[model samples]
Target: METPERGLLARLDGFFFVLAGLAAVYLAYLTLREGITPGWPMLLVVVFWVLVSYLVLPRVHRILSRVYVPDYFIGRTRTADGLLGDPVNLALMGSPTQVHHALRAAGWTRADDLSLASGWRIVTSTLTRRSYPQAPVSPLFLFRRRQDFAYQQEVDGSPSQRHHVRFWACPDGWFLPGGLRVDWLAAGTYDRSVGLSLFTLQITHKIGADVDIERDHVVATVTAADGTATVRVLPDFFTGYHSRNGGGDLIETDGHLPIIDLSRVDVAGAPEAALPVVRIGRPVQTVVGSLMTSVRGIVYAALSSLALIGSRDADEVTAATSVLLALVLGLGALGDLVLAAATFAGHNWSRLLLCASSVLGVASVVAERLVGNLGGPLHEGLLPLATSVLVLLALSSDSAREYALGRRRRRPAPADQPS
Candidate 1:
């Protein structure tokens, strides 16, 4: 994955995601607490929480991660949508079992998976001031999915705060700079408190401002537990610096990626076979993903438009307006469908057309919002607008642009013969 130079609008859009996320989370919490009464009030809060946590926040992450996170590993961990979540300050070279042994020996407990049972357990534990050493940590995505495993150590027996690290198994055939091979990449952060983020205002773990402290803490504990454990800090691996995470929590780090090698330690019976390597062009992926976003936006817009037909203005609405709206929505969907087919077939113009359409759609949404003409429920307009922006940004990426233009060099289909 590659990150192109970000324009001003893109930067603002990226920040907007964080802002929107914080707002949503706060609203959800307020709804849950204030709406907790008998009957519908309680029901509404539950629904709001679910919608914000599961549906809305995930989408926000998807959109913002692309802008804030580096596409390539620059000694940092990336969120699901490509935003910088935490710095990848630690690396381990060992089999999965060996890693387990080392961490367990270091007195860290494996965190429970984030499921309904575990989630509820953590909430109750936090509220009741109970110890939950193996409490689940909220997952941050890497390699297109959540961390393969996580380990955490409770601080002062408090369920609300802990030292945690998430580890992801390295992709097959992938190597770090200088050919350094690490089995697992990790991001370690200390939860100073359970609180809302300063920027996003979302109810999330407020990590200690200095992440380097936590990074060294992990290395120290692990190394002390096992005599065989050793660490080699890649000097200035990420460069000594201070930064902020996606939640806008302050963080300082020495850019060095600590490489811990425990390969010699025997744990599992035998090492598993290396996974098969799969390769696909990043640009092609952008095109396909953008097409999907376009389709989603088109559908939302169409549904919103149809919903508006029931308004009192229906008496004054002419057939032309209805027909025009239907035609536009149909065309938008049809365009994305065609672009998806053509882009997959290696047609370059289709990619360009897709990008053009995305830009137009986003512009239209902005225009409507600014003029106070956006109709239907607020979410109806906001959701599609957000999706359009995401699609536009994806299509504008360097990878997408290069792929589109690079493919254009193929000689035109034998025009005379085809005709």
Candidate 2:
């Protein structure tokens, strides 16, 4: 069961991530539609699309994720790029040490964090037909962040094929149905081969046709080592079904979420700590800056389109007029950067300042229409106006309000010594 607020936020998150991905695809289509016509112009467009999709969009999603993605357990997790990913098919009830001991005893090695060095190592290992028992797994998101950690086992002496599962420590006070309680939730999947994504054409892992096999394998291994632990199956927790993952690979599952109780494993250590609630303002400015950076290409195009603004030929355009136009564009860009900085520094006044800018944008567009000077289908203020609205919405979200007002509880002070 989900609260109304959580439900609404989840829907918004889904919409934003999906739409942003589609926007990237649309940009790619616009750039490559001419079948890669010869010239530096075409090359630049392709390069720009790659940067926006692969880099800029991910940053935007990460920044906004705190606002719209719920901070509690959900049945499924998201991919690093915000696409819906593997289902949460397993839960563990135990201290972190117990879980760690059981998994290691069962022969599963904790995967390395995905970084440039590890990524390159895996690529080279695969090319050389060597084994990489602890290769890193691609990131998957739960609780609006990437998995806390992952564990994997190489298969058939191949670096390209493996079984992996990502774990996320459950939020404080979260509970499951049927009196079930867990300290960690996980989504396990098996990689059968490497292939290109049908949607984005990016090279990625292709999972085996059945994910249930790996899910059961995980349960069996843990139980074999920790026989005292209990096992409970939530029948049809996600009805057994078939679907495609973010990379468009076929997936099938039995839908039973197996809850493994390792509390009796006698492993003495601290349980996994719940994550603290992060204030929204910390990342909002970065999000704004990334959005602006993504659209800088559009700004450049608009500048180029003004080549003949004041005169027919390029040389006839007056120096004063050119300087004035350039100044206007530069100032606009500078304003965004300044606002981002101010917001990050916790100045609530900066948000109001941006809201005022949005109002001005609307007024200017209306005036242009009234004066019958709306020469183009899309007005100059359109992008800025849209951006202003989005910024206002982000700043006004409940999380942002809490952050702006500094409403969080402070830690208790240490007891004073006798005077």
TM-score of each: 0.55, 0.61
Model 1 is weakest, by summed lDDT over 10 consecutive residues, at 273-282
lDDT, candidate 1, 1-419, per-residue tens: 32453354345444444444544454455445545656656666666656565545655666565566566667666544455778888889987778888888789999997877998999889888899999998767777656887899998889888999998898899898888888889999998888765444456788897887888999999888777888898887667878888677888876777888887765655445332243334454565555675577567467546845644256456655665666676666666666766765556567556555655665665566558664333434445544554554455544555555556544467756662
TM-score of the candidate numbered 1?
Answer: 0.55
Candidate number achieving the greatest lDDT relative to the actual structure: 1
- Which ranges in model 2 have alpha carbons more than 4 Å from their true place? 1-26, 33-35, 40-74, 80-82, 114-132, 143-145, 156-158, 268-337, 343-419
Model 2, position 388: C-alpha lDDT score: 42
Which residue ranges in model 1 land beyond 4 Å of their true spot?
A: 1-61, 67-69, 80-82, 268-419
lDDT of each residue in 171-282, candidate 2, tens digit only:
7887776566689899888998888765445667888878888989999988987788788988888767787776778888888888999888876554543333443435
